[model samples]
Target: MPKIDVLAPRSAYDIECETLIIGAGACGMVAALSAHQQGEQVLVVEADAVPSGSTALSAGLIPAAGTSIQRAAGINDSAELFARDIQAKAQGENDQALVDQIATDAAEVIDWLAQAHGLPFSVVSNFDYPGHSRRRMHGLPTRSGAELIDALRARCEALEIDIICERRAFALFHEAGEVTGVAVSTPDNTQETIKCARLILACNGFGGNRELVGQHMPEIKYGLWFGHDGNKGEAILWADKIGAQVTHLGAYQGHGNVAHPHGILITWAVITEGGFQVNKDGRRFWNEAQGYSEAARAVLSQPDGEAFAIFDERIAGIARQFEDFKKAEAVGAIKSSNTLEDLAEQLGLPAQALRETHADLPLGETDGFGRTFGDVPLSAPYVGVRVTGALFHTQGGLKTDTSGRVLKTSGQAFRTLFAGGGAACGVSGSNDSGYLSGNGLLSAMVLGRNAGKA
Candidate 1:
């Protein structure tokens, strides 16, 4: 975990509430809002000045089935289908009951956030994310996580829930082995104990902690960490101290193409639309169709820890719908050339190597990396983005039940202790390859609402 300060003895309670939430991300805010809606007093504390966690860095997509939106779109879906999809992608290594619960509750939670809470979410159609059989993803009008967080924060404010920002929660406070509250260190370096009837650990995972990353997920330990700095795995560490069972510690979401210097996420739509990645040596290294999270491993193992996303104008037009793509283009993160030789000269790649690579783009022709480019050859005017792999967020932490109660090693619920969002072990199972798109927020919002309701 990120280096936490040793605490001094707490003398008295600084605040008390019915429900205490650690972290102000989507999960924490949703939990707080849900609890407040139920007429319970809630308090949320954030480690940073504002409430942007990895959720704010995401595309704000949440997968759900049987929602009003889905039904209105005439797409048939069921919780069973959603659970099966998750199990298929996670290789059946997930908690079955939790998966079922998330699938069942996802639509209701998102629909509530939209209709009642005024968070404008609409079902996105005509496209498919990796590991989903149908169009089950819902996103904001802006398709930005920052906007989603703002909506949740506004709901919390409307409920008059207290949110303490820039305060770091260090440890859990317990009485007679029952979790009761949290110990927080404020910006002034003073220790304050906030006692509560229930505690929700939403402090995210260890993507930013080098030691924890090496210990749990050594495969991507050396990859660039692209998550929030405040995600120091404190929830995992503190819950472990209280005998909380940790599961799926190696699971994470890895982005294959984070445009360098510009730092904008290069959408995988480029690859799905017939774009290919090449090593710094100007050669295909792996099947680009493996999806982003899985392809990250191949990208990291490249010759110089670098790769380039090469696509034609047709694919670029398809990808321009994403805000990150628009921003990347605005910042000059993408370059274009009308010819392979000009493209090679502009990007410093081998012209002959690039030309030869495109010669075999016909259907049923497999490249050296076992990739079949069935979409025919890429058009003349080419677009390319210099890219690198990055760890976006961890999908593992404290194991919880269907209702979001943190479970002990003996399989009993830890009384008064709850976890969700990045603080909870997710549906991604035991490794990075199992990560399906939108799994992070699915686990977060579903479990967060569950914890608050319980």
Candidate 2:
């Protein structure tokens, strides 16, 4: 079984640095690059050979207002509007300070990445994601997270920052309650102590830990986890050991339509563009417009943990803009048929119920599930994929201030300790319901930058 690397050290080799970062995912990579740009000596360590985490698994949709791209696209958005959307979606349960800080710093960060680091980000105005009133999302041309990660890795390489992989960080070295460094174990089981003036935890959350998931977020115990196994809640564990206050342990991001067996995500753009979901009985169960993450529970509650995503050719063409959806089509993950009955037969569903659902969709008639029909009507060449719910990543961990300073229960900051990405409490509220689109990457990038700067 694949498991997170957690080891006990019996020996130590002394190494020193000005800043030490753990986990080379988007957060750690960005933090290292930002700190290095600021003329600070930095080092990064990763448990995996390469940095493949939730960031790489994501669709790379980053929501930020007031960006140069957004302004060029003629969008009238600002940090206050973004912060309002976040608080409203989170039901006012998240840390407003952190939310405001990220919103305010979002444009600067994106601009810096584009100008200073040569990252290509453009405004996405064609479609809207959940909880956002504007088209402020920006990403690469292909909108691929792998591309985003590759870009960050390239910048890190150019900066000549050393990223030691396959090394597990198990313990923190502290001096009188202030973290000074970390204890890392090599592939050969050799242990070393790397002392530093500052330490940032970007290792991410505990989604891979079955016990931790069961203890904190039991509702998702049966869902599929489609994130990196290296995220073992090392930051949470380490922080808790030192009296750091943790929050939103029940919060997580989930997806309602991950193509089964193919292991590729079916983009929610299909649903927003007039696609629909049905349970095993071939009947619409809920409004798919609720967004993928929020609608995950409905799909998870279906019998045998199975559901089918149904869309027409028009929506398929629109969704093909996403690389994963196109790949799903190429691998025979998406099944297509010329008629509703044929599609239902292929899905092993009742032909009559499926036909009736498609027929009534364009008539503006309300079904038992109350799904409002859009202008696009289902016709010949129906497209679909067998899908299941997935637990993407935990959105909660160590609670920190707006500046990424990890705090204690008494609200005191750890002088030399900071955290970002999955290692820190995300902007999502106390459960899975508060995850707005791009919350994970937003928290990761903004908080990572703050930690590096501070």
The TM-scores of all predictions, comma-separated, are 0.95, 0.95
Show model 1 residue runs off by greater than 4 Å: 1-12, 364-377
Query: lDDT score, residue 366, model 1?
Result: 66
How well does candidate 2 score on lDDT at residue 2? 23
lDDT of each: 0.85, 0.86
How much is 139 displaced in model 2, in angstroms? 1.1
Q: What is the lDDT of residue 356 in candidate 1?
A: 76
Question: Would you list the clashing residue pairs of candidate 1?
Answer: none
- List per-candidate RMSD values in Å: 2.2, 2.5
How would you encode candidate 1's per-residue C-alpha lDDT over 1-454 as one tens digit per residue?
1244323334567888899999999999989988888889899999899889998998888999998888988989998999999999889999888899999999999889989887777877745666788789888887778888888888888778899898888767665557767777777888778888899888888899999999998989898888898888887877656677988899999988999767788878788767888887777888876679987788888876788899889888877767888899998889999988888777778988878776756566666666666545688799898888899999999999998999988888987989999999999989888888899999999999999989
Candidate 2 residue lDDT tens string, 262-315: 889998888877788988888888877656886778888999888999998988
lDDT of 1: 0.85
Best prediction by lDDT:
2
